[model samples]
Target: MDKVLLKYAEYNEPHESCTNTDIVDILNKKHSAMKPAASGSSEDTEMMGD
Candidate 1:
């Protein structure tokens, strides 16, 4: 999905001192802190049994 394969960074021009690796590390930390939601639960489970 987008979460795994997607990645990018944003920063103010004044903060240009930040390196690519630093930005990626920060992003990784922020993302890892989030808990993954249950997959494929949005649809009707009853339909799958039919």
Candidate 2:
């Protein structure tokens, strides 16, 4: 999501604050280090068996 958001931001040019795209891009890119939810679920979890 962050990646998509950042892509949009870059496509639209710079801004004073990070746009939704930038925020989403950063979050998605940093997903691994971010905390898991209370249910301990994460995007990576779905791919574990692969």
Candidate 3:
């Protein structure tokens, strides 16, 4: 994330101007679209027959 921002900064692009809320919104959207790991919790472990 820092590297991406740095590149944007070097290029004088507006992409690097995003605030914390913007980054959190992006991350939250991405996280919601992905499944949790198999070993993520006791419930998941039971479901996996672990």
State each candidate's clash count. Answer: 0, 7, 0
lDDT of 3 by residue, 1-50 (tens): 99876775656544556899999999998787654642366677687894
> In model 1, what lDDT does residue 1 have?
66
The candidate scoring highest on TM-score is 3
Query: Candidate 1 lDDT, tens digit per residue, 1-50?
Result: 66654444343434446889999999998777652432344345656877
User: How do all the candidates rank in terms of TM-score, highest first?
Assistant: 3, 1, 2
Looking at model 3, the pairs that clash are none
Where model 1 places Cα greater than 4 Å from the true spot, the runs are 1-16, 36-50
- The better-scoring model by lDDT among 2 and 3 is 3
Worst 10 residues of 3 by lDDT: 33-42
Candidate with maximal lDDT: 3
Tell me how candidate 2 scores on lDDT: 0.70
lDDT of 2 at 15: 58
TM-score of 1: 0.38
With a 3 Å backbone cut-off (N, CA, C), the pairs that clash in candidate 2 are: 2-24, 2-25, 3-25, 5-21, 5-22, 6-21, 6-22
Q: Which portions of model 2 miss their true places by more than 4 Å?
A: 1-16, 32-50
Model 2 poorest 10 in a row by lDDT: 34-43
